[model samples]
Target chain A: MNADQLADVVAGVSDPEIDVGLRDLGVLRSVSLTDGRIRVHLTPTRLSCPAVGEIARRVRAALAEAAPGHGIEVVWERGAWQPAAVTAAGRDALRRGGYRVAGTAPRCPYCDSEDVEQAGRFGGAVCKVPYDCRGCGSTFDVIGTAGCNAMLPTPVRGGSR
Target chain B: MPHIPTDSDVYEVFAQSGHGTALSHVGSIVSPRPDAAWHLAKETYGRRDDLVKLWVVRRTDMIVSSAGDRDLLAAKTRMPYRQPGFPTARRRDRSAAPPAVAAPPERRDSGLTERRDDAREPRLTDLWLALADDLFVLGNRLGERIVDYIDLEEALAVGSIGQEALAHAGTILVLCGFDQPAVDARFFDRAQAQWQVSRVVERLTDWPSLVAGGLVIAAAVAVLAERTAEAEPGAEWLSAISAIRDEQLVHLDHWRRWARALAAWPETRTEFARAYAEVTECAGDMFGARPQSQGQGVPAAAPPAGPALAVTLHERLAVLVGDNGGPGSRLPDGPRTRTWGVGGSALADSLSRGRAIRDHYAPGVFS
Candidate 1:
């Protein structure tokens, strides 16, 4: 019905890991509409995160209802997502949701207990890692963004010894 | 043993405000403060007014987690097949462990090659081989010797060491961008090429030999892992190896405890030393034991100083293995009795074969 209201629809897409919306999480970089086509730019907290595809899908679905017959494209650029973009509320929500911002033991999202132990770093899923909450004796998944050793000491393919 | 960080990082001061109330935690704040604790409680739990007590605990204090008064980190995971008196490796289904988080595929071999082009020296391939091969061969031998133990605890320890060794080998393989089967085919399939590993297995077959081997291997790995952690504390390569290293240090402690236990018996200690003397020369080569020349096939390693870690590991391993009151106890055992005959011709052939491995790898080059 209106230009500004139609443009704000994709902002409602929430990050799967954290329950906060894209706009609130500061991942939604910019959204502009032109000639029945909407271009949305989003950024990821981690480059290797697999949730990028899911978030894009949610953006498309959210936009389909408001801007019918309009082509909506969600694009992500590396280095676009900044920690400063995350709102105060988003950070608080993440803490409340049992995820630590800095690399420390996270509180239990379920029991809200700080007595949580990291079970292992090799969390099988790309987005979430495995952690055991000792307080309630329950195991849960949290955002797994710890291992970022991108510049590995590469080996040259040499003949067998 | 539970891991204690070499340095204390932070203190999470909790102002209980009251006795029965909870303690609050925060990031590194070295100052004595009821005020900061007050703010943390207010921000995190919104319960500042309910406190009249305070507990300033060191960060490492929380690091030591306890389960029934025992350090949970030191607790041995009793693997069923690893249980003592188990006769064969075939009966034991090697468990599925936490898989390695390899660096992105594109960057795996390419990074080392690019770095090699700029710096024309062998990268730490020798160290990598030593670590990888030690883990692989030790794990295989340990698994094979599982029947030697009669006690449940000792057996479990043996199994745990072997299993963990295999798991670590996988990560080391991934990090080196080498295939496990390929490595197995290269070293494991052929006995002659296994100069570093065979020295241990060739002379010693009993459980005490396993203990001695376990002692040296675990100690070496622990030292290397600690050094690696210091070098790349927050790196991705460090990430996979670091986690494995933490637990491996526990395995090291477990083997040390076993070694200490075996040392209590004089007969067992003698057997251990007998086994030690056999593999002593090639012990340094445990990291990069291959006697072959480092041709163009080898990639350039940063900080190229022939296997410094190996030398350090060997020296540290000596201190550990020598602690059993056996003062200069590394008594030489006679000509290595082989599956083949112990005749003069056989002995002469074996001596030359062994010398080649020693000469190729170079004994004191690590320093």
Candidate 2:
């Protein structure tokens, strides 16, 4: 397979948890043919994330099948995965799947109501926070911005939206 | 008479929205007591947020670092090796064929190996072992008591703090040139008498005692780690040590907050004070001289002096329990001067318990 075909095969792998393609999720940092071998670099969402090992394994298996007899290497890059790295298409896909991406203003996922209150700074996962909607009377988890510094005190309106 | 809450009674509120999630700082509330603070936190934050757990610690109980100490609490340079991905990246690099062109020659002597004026001081290995063992022992003891905590939030916090201590211990062992298997053996199979842990960590019998004793030892360790990091700027492990010291500060803050909270309450006040006194009694010798092995002539380096470390510990303890007109005011002064060493039966018991758990799981064997 050519470089483009090889890249496509590598990008086909999806994150087990998020169910998004590696390329769309910004996990596929780079894919290049170096020294006649296929080398793929990936950056994890978090250093201690359990999905990293599985992702690497899947990537290796996918590449081996796509480009037979070619040596394949999956290199994990040393750096934090930034939420900003999410492609626009990836964001849209995530939203369609009922997942909120960080940096966007938080609203009720259920009713799309702007009148929301933060019920908890932490959610089921480290990257998410639980928010309650005054409109729908339901709580939903929103993917929080990457770091604690991003957690500014969001203003809450007294009246209905 | 019921005490009226005031601005001076500000409490920092932390909340967890789901089971097994860590509590994060949300905001602050002003209340006279912990119970009152919890109620106010729910009233203030629960209206909009869906909080399942909350922690209300008084602002006064926090140990804030000064602006000058920023470097001590953070890594000044990138430490790629510290990241989980580093080993994989390194392995890939090694497996790749060597570059066609020859690589540049390595430096003859990095500044790390150069002898300094304080060369006569004790080796970093000995100091690291002492610090690592202390944390390892404390981590095990704290972990053992996690299930005993009635409150889920407290139990989670204890488990997290314990895990952090163990991680720090492992990092220190790595710095001392021990691989993963070596670290496991040193942690689980080492003889009881060989442990260099301070006496303060060994006698934690109950919740109140754990809080008080943890506060004292955490303070001492934080101070010692900071001093070591400052003294050894050229050390290769500087960044790692700084990172560990930063987490040590967090541990210190947790213990400080709990110690103060327990002392302020009517129910736990007397018990907390008694635990504090008992721990401090034997804590004096915590910073004493490192004992030399038999027939080993001169010690490599002198341990941080007992009085100096004791003075720092005293000052910090004072900040926690000193001027407060509550039950803490009645507690004894900081650790007195004495020789402290590893516990005998306490160490044996803890080690045995750890071995039992390890055997039951039989690590490396899949069920």
Candidate 3:
């Protein structure tokens, strides 16, 4: 398959933790078909990402099934992954799933209170951050993994506050 | 199979300020349940200091753009005022504000008190905690759904969704001011010890949709080694079992680390850990029982006792600095700069003071 098509395939892989696609979530970095073989590179949000092997295996198997005896070489690129905002389209899908996308300020996912604040770096899983809300005065976790914070790419220097 | 449209969830997050400022949104939380959504929002958004509140909802409730539609870029025929194109410098400046009062400094907290008193009334820390919690839960959810794929395109979509969930969650966490201790440290130590799995999904070709599908089964085996051992399954099911095991392992690691850190401090650690565990339970139930209560969906109020880590840290710093008199008084009163010998003194002092105030009223909560 072509690189773009291959990338689409890689992006479709689901994360066991959050149950979303890689492309929409911003995990799969690059997918290339080189020298009669397909290579996929990805960064995990956390250091010891639990789903890496699973993700790779799934990708390989999917490609093989789709191409029928296609030689696929899925490579795990080294880098700490950080979470990224989904494309506008992805956001739409999430909205359909009964979620509210942040418009002005990023809102909390727990109490619907705007009085929420960040809590910890690590969420229960690799791709998330724990937060707390004041209106409800409670804490919860958010999804994150695969970009600057995760260590794969040097995020825009000093981009996030 | 008929195409089932996905639903979007809305997550509300806020930020807290030390000087009594209303919490503001840092990011969002994604979840099917309002209670679980909000709890996750708080943890993800408010892991740092001075947090106050969190909010979350389903994307379906929020009005937004969709994936299939290309209308976002449709050109406006008339009414230039309504269009959101580039604006002249002067117009841009004027549009942003009345153009009378000078822009406030980025880090300045000038009208904090007034803002706190405003109808919005959210603390800075609360906003952050909620965002963080939202992201964490969303990430976990992504893990649950992304595993065991059918084809390349689907796999890519799964990874994309998972990554997006994580990114939003991270934005909330950072903006809210939570600190990550070990960048490379996995969330769960014990889980990691048992399983060595990766979080990146790489789909090359088309497979199937079910977790029991062949592609998913292979992925599961490669990713979830430990869980495979725990589940007695035939070789045919190895892939699927492994996929779940791997995802759980990674997820467990993250939770374990988070729990341990929240519990590492003095008084609040236990409560923090306990509350956090309840909020993001693996089984989505009781910590030790079958009928677990995740604060009934909304975040349970801060345990009667808050985290004592701040208090203990404060007390320890007080004793240490008190004995040494700390840095011989050369530190400046502005934002602390150095982490060197005397530089750390200010941080210690600040921690001590805040802890003292919080603990004075609550006692054992921090003492």
Candidate 4:
């Protein structure tokens, strides 16, 4: 199968934490095909995401139908997850899930409070930040993981705060 | 979410915006029972009239109070009141008579919290750089301790954390507008005299204390990162901070797991306690620090900035170690605060001694 078609297959794999596929969450950093091997580099929303193994397994499971008998090795890459990596569709998914995405300020996932503030660093895990919604005064976790915070190549411009 | 759909039976409403996207929740509608809920929800939230589908779920089914089981919910609720952003609203309009009503800094539950106004982000950027310096040093120390790993897993985990830390430190250095050589000069080559990291960093005689100490330090940094991210100056660093925080999540988990595993043994508690004592001052200095230090160098006093991180390291350490005392309750009961200064172990030592000396000479230094 062509890389685009194969990518679509792996992209369909759902993120266990958030209800979006790897492609939308932007964790699917790259997918390439060479010499009868399918190489997928996935960025875990967090460094120690417990679902790393599970996500890889699911990617393998999904790829079976599309690229049967191909070598699929999921390599977790360096760019720590960033919200900017999230596609527009992924953002809609987050908003629909009651998580608000405002500029640098973390919007409340539970209350959609635009007036949010940081509650703590370790939001239960590495890829999450504990944020308190000023509107509801309730603290909830926001997905802090995305592609690397470094500015992307100008052409691939998907900048998010 | 009980408590969420309080007045009536809360039915969650999901709507399809168009084709392609899955049905997402628009809003909720309250009704006497489940049947009438969807109809009311449609009328309430479907006013846009573009929805192709809708689904109402009993709010009870969607109640996720977080991954924390019944036990941790209480402690989790008591997170310190410091708002985690390098709040831009404060920076955008600095006039004492702000035309717009800004978000109140500490409205949560009368906790002594850091207000958004006090997080002078540009100044705090400097603090973050200082933090990067501290982390670089600690990461180096942690890297050295990789040899003390109980197993491959421990070594791998600690080694990964150390590497991530150094990388984060590099990012912060870059963010501080430093060139590579300057970063190398400040972080790698020279000693940040003010980085009085809690002596516990050096005192990590065993694995448990090391993990415990790292946990407290990470928590303090996490809080700082959150606050900084909320600020205007911190916009560029948000993604980096978030990514770094993700590593912290791993660090916290590994350390907590390590500490907890050791807790089964008797000596680990003492070790944990020792870590707490050693790191507590460093943690305090790291957050609500006074400008002076154990080093003879003078501290530059900015406007009386609130403790960047209002949470007490002692309390956070207590909870992490399973003492579960609940935020330094057993310690002197008062508003959460510390003498604001650069974070480090030596700073912790200097601060403690400084507090004593300051009180001795000035008598009312605290008062």
**Tens digits of per-residue lDDT for model 3, B1-367:** 2233355555556666445776566787666667677678667776676455444445555555556556654665764433445234434543464312222222322221111222322222232232223233334334434434333333343454345435433433332332332111111111111111111111111111111111222222222233223334444323322333334333333333333443455764545533332222211100011111111211122121112322332233223222222122121222111110111221222223333454467544421
TM-score of each: 0.39, 0.52, 0.29, 0.39
Give the TM-score (0 to 1) of chain B in model 1.
0.49
Best by lDDT: 2
Candidate 2 residues B257-350, lDDT tens each?
A: 6776877789987887888777766565444325322111012233543455546645654554332212433333544422233564445556
Candidate 3 CAPRI assessment class: incorrect
State the TM-score for model 2. 0.52
User: For residues B33-80, what per-residue lDDT tens digits would candidate 4 score against the true structure?
Assistant: 777887888788887767888888887776556444567465655432
lDDT score at residue A98, model 4, on the 0-100 scale = 54
Q: What is the TM-score of chain A alone in each candidate?
A: 0.63, 0.79, 0.69, 0.78
Query: What TM-score does chain A of model 4 get?
Result: 0.78
* Clashes in predicted model 1: 13
lDDT of model 4 at position A151: 22
The TM-score leader among the candidates is 2
- DockQ, all candidates in order: 0.02, 0.02, 0.02, 0.04
State candidate 3's DockQ.
0.02
lDDT of 2 by residue, A15-69 (tens): 7877789888777888888667998888665332446668988998998888878
* Span of ten consecutive residues with least summed lDDT in model 1 chain A: A152-161
Cα deviation in Å at residue B115, candidate 4?
27
* CAPRI category for model 1: incorrect
